[model samples]
Target chain A: MATKSVAKKQVETPDGLTEIRWHGRGGQGAVTAAKMVAELALGQHKYFQAFPEYGPERSGAPIVAFTRVSDEPIQVYAGIEHPQIVVVLDPSLLSIVDVTKGAPDDAIVLVNSEMSPTELRKHYGLEGFRYYTIAATRIAVETIRRPIPNTPMVGALTRITGLFPIENVVNFLREDFGKKFPPKVVEGNINAITRSYEEVQGE
Target chain B: MATTDRDILAVTGNEATAEAMCQIDPDVVCAYPITPQTEVVQLYAQMVADGRVASEFVTVESEHSAMSAVIGSAAGGARTMTATSSQGFALMWEVLFVAASYRLPVVMTTVNRALSGPINIHCDHSDTMGGRDTGWVQLYGENHQEAYDNCIQSVRIAESMDVRLPTMHMYDGYVISGAIGPLQMLTKDEVQQFIGPYRSINPMLDTKKPVTVGPFDGLHGWYFEHKVAQNRAMDRALQVIQDVADEYAELSGRQYGLLDPYRLEDAEIAIVVVGSTAGTTRMTVDKLRARGVKAGMVRVRAFRPFPHEAFAQALQHVKVVGVMDRADSFGAMGGPVFLEIRAALYDCDPRPQVLPFIYGLGGRDIFPDNIEQAFAQLEDVAKSKKRASSERRYLNLRAD
Candidate 1:
C-alpha cells in the first residue's frame, strides 16, 4: 500500500487557492520568486493567488511570500499550512523558521546550497521524503557576478521539485529579465538558470 | 417556482452574495478568506478563472492586505469587493474605516459570524456590530435568497456616485451562509444594463494627473466636510436603494427594498430581529398568530444610517416592540440592533413600549421557540422590573 503520492501543485487554485508559504531573505528574491511562480502558473491558464508577507525584514532578513492555488478557488487566507511544496531560495533558512512545518510530510523541499547531495542529507534530518540543494549562490556570483541568486535558485527549484517544466522556467526567465534589465542581463540570467539546472543536487 | 433567470441559482447565502457581486461586476477582488464569508470571495475567484467573469483577483496575505488592496483599487476608480467574517472582519478593522472615510465604493460581504474568545463559528450579530461605526453602509440580509439579492441591491446603494461609500452586506454566518435555497436572479445582460459602468470619483492614480488621498495632515474643517459629505452621500444611498430595487424588480420579476414585514398589521406586540435570526422569529410569529395573540415580527434589513423613516412607519400601529439583539453592547440599552432600532423609533408619535432582549452570541444555535420566550420580556417588563438584570441576561455567558 506504499503508493507514491503525485507531486502536489504549489498553489492548488487557479485564482483563489489553499495557501503557499515562502521563507527567504529580502534580497534573495523571495517576493519576486512568488510572483514568478504566480505568472508561470497564470501562463498555464491556471488560477492563482500570490502575495508577500514582509515586516521590517531588511536585505538578508527572512521575508515570506504566500501563494494559495486551487482548482475550485481558495479562501482560507491567514497563512499557509498543508502547502504542496516549499521554495527556500536561501539555504541558510534551515536554522531559522521551520519551513517544513507547513509542508506535508511527503512534500518537496528545494534549497540553494553548495553542500553535496549526500552531505545535505547527512547534515539535515529530512525524514519523510524528497529533498534537494543546488550551488545556486556560487553560480550566481561566478556567472551573473550579482549578489542576486534569485533566478539561479529558481532554476534549482524547478529542476529539483519539478513544479514547473525546465523549458518553461527558461522562457519565464527570458521574459521576466527582459522587463527591467537590458538584453545582456537577460542573457546572463538565462545562462545562470541553465548552469544552475545542471549543477542541481541529485543525478 | 417560476423559471429561474440565467444569473439565478439556488445557492448558499454567501454564494448568493457572491453571485450578486458578480452581477454587479467589480474590477478587483482582494480578500483574506474566513468561513462563511470565504464562499463569496471564492465564487468570485472561480468566476474570474472560469472566464465567467473578468476581474483582477488580487490574492492577498491577510484581511488587512485584502482590505488595503481593495481600498487602493476602489480609490483608483474600479469597483472592488471583498468578504470576511468574525475574527477576519475584526482583523480588517484597520482598513474598514479607510474604505469608508476615503469614500471608495467598495462592496464587502461579511457573513455575520460570532466573535471569538470561546472560539465558536456560528451565527451572531456581534461581528457586524463591531464594524457598525466604521463609516461603511451596513445592510443585513434575512435569508439565502435575500443574501443573494441584497448584495446586488447594496452595490447600487453604496456606489450611487452620490453615495460613493463602502457597504458591508451582512448575512448570518452558518445559518444562511451555508444553507442553500431558491432565489430569483437577474439575467447577466439585464444586470449589466442595470448597473452599467462604474464611473469612479475625480482623481485616479495617473502620473499625468497628480492627486493626494488619506494624507496624514488634513485641516479640521476639511475633516468635517468629509464627514458631512459622506453622511449626505449615505442619504443618497437610501434613494439609490429605492431606485435600484424598483429597477431590479422590473427586470428580474423579484422585489426587495429595506425592511421585510412578516405581520404587524394591527398588532400590539412585535419582535424585531436581523439576519438569519429573523427566520426563527418568523416561525415564532406563525405560532403566536395561531394562538390568537396579535404578535408580529419586523426583520430589519437596511441597517446603515438606519431606515429611521421606514422603521418609524413600520412601528406606527404597534404598541409593544420586543427588540432581540444578537450582540450585547456591554451597558448600553441591550443588543447592538436593539439600541439602533430604539434610536430610530425614538421620535415616533407615541413610541411603542420598547423592551430589549439579548441573545445569541458566539455562534450558539438560536431556536425558534426562544423567540416568544424573549418577546415575553415585554410583558414581564410591563408586570415587574424588566430592567432589573442590568440590561443583559448573559444568555450564552454566565446568567449572573
Candidate 2:
C-alpha cells in the first residue's frame, strides 16, 4: 500500500493464483486474449477457466473478459470484483473508467500507457497500488503490425507476474496460433510478445 | 365404516405425491429442488431405491440441467417428468419453453413456493406465475389429494397424442406439499390404463428414422419453419385438455378440467380466483351470501388457453367482479388474474368492471379472515373506481 512507484523483482509466493480481468472495447480481441491464456495454461497442464461476460453489448462499447488459474478446483462463481491483476488494452479508456476502483492494495495493474506512473497518479491517481505500464499498441504496431494488443499484453502480464515461465507462455502462443494463423503472423505475434515481456516495467 | 381403498396414511404431502409420480414409473425424472420442494425429489429417490418405481432418475446439478435432461429424454420419446419451484422454476425458464416449442409433451409439477428477495419456503402462486406463458398448459391443485391425483393425470394430459405441448401441475409447496391429510391414490391398473405407453410423432434418438434436434438455423430457413409448426401444435393442445380431462374423470371418478364454479347461478357479484385461494374464497363467498350479500366463486383450474368463454360466462350477470391473485404481475394494470378476467369481460355488452386485489404473497398465510379482508378491499376498489397501486404491492406486507 506504499504511495511510491517502484519496479518489482522476480519473487514467488507459496501459491498465488493470479486472476486477470481484461478491459477493452468490443472486437478488440480481449476475449481472444482470455482464450489464449486459458489455452496456454491448459497446454502447460495447469487448469483454467477463461470466459467472456457479454450480453448484447455493441461494438466499441467497453467489455471485460476474465481468466482464473489455480492449483485447486475453482468454486467461486461470481465475476471478478477485485482482480489481482488488471490489463487495459486501450489507453484512451483511462479517462472514462476508473479501472482501479476496486483493485486490491496488493494488486498489480498493467496498462498500455506511455504516461509515467508518477504522471498517471497525478492525473488518474494510482491510489498506491503496484502497477506496470506497457505501450502494447506501439509493440503490436512495431512487431505484430496489428492494432490488437492481446499478444503483447500477454507478454507484459507474463513478464510482470512471472505467473509462469516465459518459454511456457511463448509455447502456448505458438500452439494456439499455429492452427489458425499463417506461420509469419504467428512468428510476428511471438516477437511482439517477447518484446513486450522484455520492456514491461513492474512495480 | 372405513374402505380398504386408497386413503391418506400419515405422511408428508411432498413425500406422498412424489411417491405417486415414482409409482407412474417415468422413463426419466430430472429435478433441482428449492426449499419445500426438495423433499419431492428426495422421496422419488427413495422410491427408486425401494424398487417400487423402475425408472432412470437423473439427479441433475441445476434446475437448468433438470430441464435440459428432460428435453433430451422427451425428444428421445421417453415419458419424462421433472419437478421444481421458485427460483428453480425461474432458472429453468429458457428450457421450460423449449420443451413445449419442440413439442416433447413433458410433465412438470411445480411444488409451488414463494420467490425470493427475502426468501420464504412456503406455499404461494409466485413460483408458477413466472411460467404462465411458456405455452405449457398450467393446472393448480387445491390440496394434497389433488396434488397426488393431478400428478398422474398430468402425465396422461401432457403425453397424449392430441396434446403434445408440455404441462405443469402446480400445488402449494407447504400448504399442500408439507401438509398430511386424508389422501386417495389411483390403483396401479387404473393409472396404467389411463396413461398408455408413450407414442411420440418425431423422436430424435431412434435410428430407424433419425431427425436432427437442437440445431442452430437461419431465421428464414429451418428455425422459422419449426417455430410455425410449434404454434399449430399448441392450438391442437387446447382441445386435448378437454379430451384428456373428460376421459380421465370418467376413469378415476374425480372431476377436473378448468374453472370449477361454486353457486354463481344468478349472483351480481362474482369472485373469480385461481389455485388454492379458490377454496378459501369459496368459504368467504358462502359467509358473504349467508349475510344476505349476493356473492359467488369461480375457481380457475387451468391457466393456459385461459378458459376465456367459460370464465366470461361465469361472470354473465355480475355487476362487480373481484379478482384475487396470490401473486402480482408487477407494473401491470392488474394482477395476473385481473388481466385475463377483465379481458374475458371486455366483449360483453353489460360486463363487470374487474377490481384486482393482490394478496397472500411469499406464502403469507391467507386464512378465512384474510379472504374477508380481500373482499372488503375489492368493495373499496369498486366504490372508489381506482386501484391502490398500478404497480404491484406486497399483499400482506407486515407493518414493521
Sliding window of 10 residues with minimal summed lDDT for model 2 chain A: A5-14
**Which digits, one per residue and each the tens of the lDDT, describe model 1 over residues A71-190?**
542222223556666777787787777787746555666677788656776776444446667777788887788867778877776676555687887787787778888988888888
Provide TM-scores for the models.
0.63, 0.63
The parts of candidate 1 lying over 4 Å away from their true place are A1-203, B1-9, B206-208, B219-221, B379-390, B393-400
- Encode model 2's per-residue lDDT on A134-200: one tens digit a residue: 8888888888787878889999888877767899877766876788889889899999999989988
| lDDT of candidate 1 over B56-174, digit per residue (tens) | 88999999888999988987878888889889889899888888999888888888877877877767888888778888888887766677677777777777867878988888776
lDDT of 2 by residue, B1-400 (tens): 2233444343446766786786688888888777778898888888888888888889888999999999999988788998888889989989887888788888888888778878666666887877887878788877666777778878877776666778898887655565433355767766777787778777877789989887767656677677677667666665677777788677666677767888798776777777767766776777788887777878888787587888877786777777878888777887788899889889987767677777767666565666677666555655675544434333456888
CA lDDT of each candidate?
0.72, 0.74
Highest DockQ: give the candidate number: 1
